[model samples]
Target: MAKLTAEIKESLAATKTAYFATAAKDGTPNAVPIGAYKLLDDETILVSDQYFNKTLANIKENPRVALTFWGEKGGYQIKGTVTIHTSGTIFTEDVAWVKSLKATLEPKSAIVMKITGVYTIKPGPDAGKKIL
Candidate 1:
């Protein structure tokens, strides 16, 4: 398990769009820009499955996922394992939040990822170094 620092949390919060990557069981890769997502806690992030098809299928076949976000300064890549929730307290909460943002947004499911590793993606001497 990895813990998210305050700086990382702030960057993620300010990020309007992030890239989520996943691979199918056969190793086909899928990466997409996710607009409806949020930090559920220090160790968890939630992504709404609004129009996910391949991403959802890949997640079900393989839980591993990677998220990359570029902020004003730079960005970091977060690697973790995801659990897809369709019906549960977390799902309900996520749906409500999505609805509040836009009543038209309907989340089919919620992808919850537990932070496992973090890496700096900012172009610098420390780029690609694992922070956690």
Candidate 2:
């Protein structure tokens, strides 16, 4: 089974940039650039405010999602289902949660996701995970 590694956590926490992939009802995948996503736990993730777009809507209808992070060396791909949150709650009811999304610039428009699995891609120069 896929597991979250220290390296994966480091990359996700260190880089604030990622591309979220959501699919239309027909199963066509749509990818967009996003900057605010929080790993609430080993399986939960939070975006921000009304920041959800097609991807968000898609996730609401179909919880399946793919979130990714990349750098000069390599990157990790996180795929999971998002449990929709339409309004505020104890977790996202303060500036601290708001402050975490400063990377997004538009902190007010953010959406979070709950990750379920972590996939290693472009593993290394000598070894790599097969993209299947």
Candidates in order, TM-scores: namely 0.96, 0.72
Highest TM-score model number? 1
Q: Could you tell me the lDDT of residue 5 within candidate 2?
A: 62
Candidate 2 structure quality by residue, lDDT tens digits, 1-132: 244666676777787678888887889898888665666666566665435567766776776888877864457788876565444673454236666545344344335565666666664663334332
Candidate-wise lDDT, in order: 0.92, 0.64
Best by lDDT: 1
Worst 10 residues of 2 by lDDT: 101-110
Cα shift from native, residue 25, model 1 (Å): 1.5
